[model samples]
Target chain A: MDSRVLRTRRDVLTAAMDELVEGGWDAVTHARVAGRAGYAKATLYAHWPDRLALVRDAFDQVGRMPHHEPTGDLRADLVGELVSFRTAMTEHRLDRALAVLAERAGPVPELVEVRRRFVEDGERPMRLLLAPVLSGARLEAATAMLCGAVVHATLLHGAPPTDEEVEAAVDLVLVGVTGA
Target chain B: MDSRVLRTRRDVLTAAMDELVEGGWDAVTHARVAGRAGYAKATLYAHWPDRLALVRDAFDQVGRMPHHEPTGDLRADLVGELVSFRTAMTEHRLDRALAVLAERAGPVPELVEVRRRFVEDGERPMRLLLAPVLSGARLEAATAMLCGAVVHATLLHGAPPTDEEVEAAVDLVLVGVTGA
Candidate 1:
């Protein structure tokens, strides 16, 4: 893809995502997205034929917001990443939009693949952060628990969570595994 | 308030819950619930003026599932409760049904109250289990993480978690707090 085309695509997708956040999945219709992006509906349909395609592109954009680079200190890095993700979830409407799309899509293969990729992408940094702090089975369990807790706290509670909570959760898991 | 009337009301609500699980929230219409329960639409209306009321009653029933009594061992009790809840979430459609409803309702005041009640009920037993093992703020954080993890594992992953995973999570939180 040409760089300028890629940039325009990114802009269109970003506008669609904003519409989704503001008005739920129904708001991401090509017409509305194009209107929001100041483009004709034909332009959107030219790039993405269906609602799902548009949503998929919008999700791709939203899913890339997390900075997954790992720092050497597993706890600090994990906490920082979780806090950042949590802040985005709480402050931005995108998280709810993604969740709504996921729920509404049901068992569609494309949506399922998108969900799985989203999960893997979200979990990748945590796994890396944990690999250094833990070894063997302990690392696996800790990573699952940490990621599980963060997702639960943000999605269910409607807040990004505090550093203290994240630190305590990480410490709890690490202590149990190492018996330190 | 009559005994037979109360029984009929309960039956209608149970049928509504079944429909919700079978077809998700959108399927829980008054006529469908009435037909499923072999009741007249008038009876359903008498008991629940709206779909939300019927769904709310069903959610209450689901929440009334058996809870684990504290056994003084925080890790054991926490793990047991989580595993049991995970099983219910998987085996009973009502559990997932209510979750779907809650997510759709978002931050609406009535729905928020329902969510708060759900979390409190789920966390209360775990808190009792952990109280002896932890003190002060650690106890609060531990309960939140444990409860949060279980909810996420079931709702997001759509799988029944094993006792081993629950044990690992409890151990992680317990060890961190007690430094044991």
Candidate 2:
């Protein structure tokens, strides 16, 4: 790749994500990303048009969490997905990416779609893990409880929940799902 | 209140909140707020220094939720608080105020303090409601799960949970507390 103008649209978008990962949504500004991508600000704006647009593109590559192998233990599998969720939130700086949408007054629909996809992708593994044991509204509540626990913990604590916290949270949901 | 300069500090702060409530954080820009407060941008900037500072002051007055008269029933009390919470989030425009801090790459210390107070204020009733029935890690876990559910539902749906949804959530938690 040449130092001058020598890349495709993918390169610019990748650079936007690189900035987001390194710094956060604030880091995806026109000046920094354009310089990093070796594209003129004019060209970058021509495509993404704004910081939110660039950030939208960046989120496309997000929410692909690592696969959690189910050990055939319902409790363990549930905990596994949640711990993985916490890990992903922290390690990937998703807390900040989420902040991008979480701060809107009226959510921008396109951005909301990005958040929806990220959520659906994150929950897919959990859905698969819980389907056999839990179904319908119970499963929905459980998912909300577990996922909401992680989010609320972060909101309150300014960081992700600890592994023990995640375990305890999952246990709270377990009785709800498995009790007589 | 005079048309020109006939108010107290309370009026300005109130106006800032008015903007936050009506248009969210984005609407609290220097020009709009300064104009609304009947103060010049210089005056607003002198006090606030920046958008975040003004927002910081606005949040100081936030988090006073209405009293939920607790019935003797723990389940009803719990559901009452969660329902009140959902209502507050929708009515007070707390969702957008929260987004001001939520979108940050890092949680602002001062704003986080505001959020802390808000959470504590919101949860005080719940703490009192549950103290008789729960304590230690169980209490902590339950608090996180319930609050997290509200936050997660808002994030996923872009609106606060309906009253029925809040009731369903309390049931999910109640089962955990009262086992088979």
What's the DockQ for every one of the candidates?
0.45, 0.50
User: What residue runs in model 1 are displaced by over 4 Å at the alpha carbon?
Assistant: A68-71, A105-109, A135-137, B69-72, B107-109
TM-score of 2: 0.85
Q: What are the candidates' C-alpha RMSDs?
A: 2.9, 3.9
Writing each residue's lDDT as its tens digit, candidate 2 over A106-142 gives 5455667777777777778887876776766666666
DockQ of 2: 0.50
* The 10-residue segment with the lowest total lDDT in model 2 chain B: B1-10
Q: What does candidate 1's lDDT look like per residue over B115-180, in tens digits?
A: 556656766777777787776546655766676666555555544455666776776776676774
Q: What are the clashing pairs of model 1?
A: A172-B172, A172-B176
Candidate number achieving the greatest TM-score relative to the actual structure: 1
Task: Spell out the clash pairs found in candidate 2.
Answer: A103-B99
Residue A18, candidate 1: alpha-carbon lDDT: 81
